[model samples]
Target: MIKSWLKEMEAEYRIEILFASETGSRAWGGATVHSDYDVRFIYKHHDVRSYLSLRKAQETMDFPAPYDAQGWDIYKAFHLLQKSNPGLCEWAFSPILYHDCQNFSSKLRRFVTESYSLISLFHHYIHLMDRNLKDIRGKAFTEKRQKQFIQAVRAFLLAKAIILEQKVPVMALYSSFSSSFPKDCTIVSFYQQLMEAKQSGELVSYADIEDAIFMMEQERPLLLELSYGLSKGKSIENELNQWIWELLHL
Candidate 1:
């Protein structure tokens, strides 16, 4: 269904789809049965003249629908890549691919993996985890709150990976990034149970998981300390330009 939709969209807009993938909870391997598909893609104009025109081309598209879909123009995607945007990095390395024309995603993933800024990704996850932590701390427990708590945990794990591993966290399973944590720790045990509960449609209150939340709070300082030792990555603009040339001609 998604592939057909992409074909239709490509034909209609006269754009070449570089790649498309599942994102959000499903891409992270943390989604429940009720989770919706979040489809994102990268594309470029089929006509090279569009790049030379005086009028600005649309850099993004958000479609309403039977399928939740969005897209970024390749130029905009490379611009964000140069800035080491964590969201773009995730899309580049997303585990589930719906479309990958001429292995475009693989090429982009290699660039992102090698050159994405450590500090950018580290702080991105840090801010994300912190915001969700606030929600978990202050909000009344409900299904929405439970989702927020899960989001916080996922962010914490990814942030922890960035600071310690010094690499893009691309694993589909967020729990798989727990190598730094102790093998039999409360965090690990709680995460496993929490995932099972979420998948089973079980309702868990804030009180039920308060200790684990505190554990995450206590570890925040250590992550910051590790982040201090990270190096900012190099520029990929020249390489991205080469990609633009090659992709345009292909």
Candidate 2:
């Protein structure tokens, strides 16, 4: 079904998909049985002339309903990559690949690893956790919304891990938490319960995540200090341009 849909998209848009994969919970290894496949891809147009026009081609495409499908144009993806866009980095490194141009994915992965900004990814995870926490604020926590709480915990751990390790956190939330916090810690057990609940399709109602939250709060000031001291990294535009030329067979 996914392959057929990709083919249909390629024909309809006159674009070649260079890389594609499953993202979100499924790719991050915290998915419930009911989780949906979040398919994301990077593609490029065949008509290079269109890219040179003052009016740019649409950089993204989205399909609603039936199955969630979305794609980013290669040009836009590369631009984001240079800025250390966390979403693009996640998509590039997603564990569950659907379709990928062998050379392109590998090259992009290496570029990201070399050029990634610890500060940028750290901020990204912090913003994600902040937003999730805000959404749950002043609301009554219940069994039905346990999934949201689990996600919040995951985001917080990822943000904390980025600062403590001075690197991008692992894609899997469980691994990120384990690596950051000791195995025998109560917080680890708390997170483990949440993970098991999410995977087993059970509600993780009202976990005592206060300790985790406190740790993040204490770490925030130090993280901000480190972020201010770091550089945003250099552009890989020349390399990306060459890749684009090769991909278009120009």
Who wins the lDDT comparison? 1
TM-score for all models, in order of appearance? 0.93, 0.87
* Regions of candidate 1 where Cα sits further than 4 Å from its true position: 172-181
Specify the poorest-scoring 10-residue window by lDDT in model 1.
171-180
Q: How close is candidate 2 to the true structure, as a TM-score?
A: 0.87
- Tens-digit lDDT track of model 1 for 132-173: 878767667777777777777777777876765677776523
Error at 108, model 2, angstroms:
1.3
- Could you give candidate 2's per-residue lDDT for residues 159-217 as a string of tens digits? 66666665566544325366567678665577678778778766554435555566656
Question: Measured by C-alpha RMSD in angstroms, how accurate is candidate 2?
Answer: 2.4
Number of clashing residue pairs, candidate 1: 0
Clashes of each: 0, 0
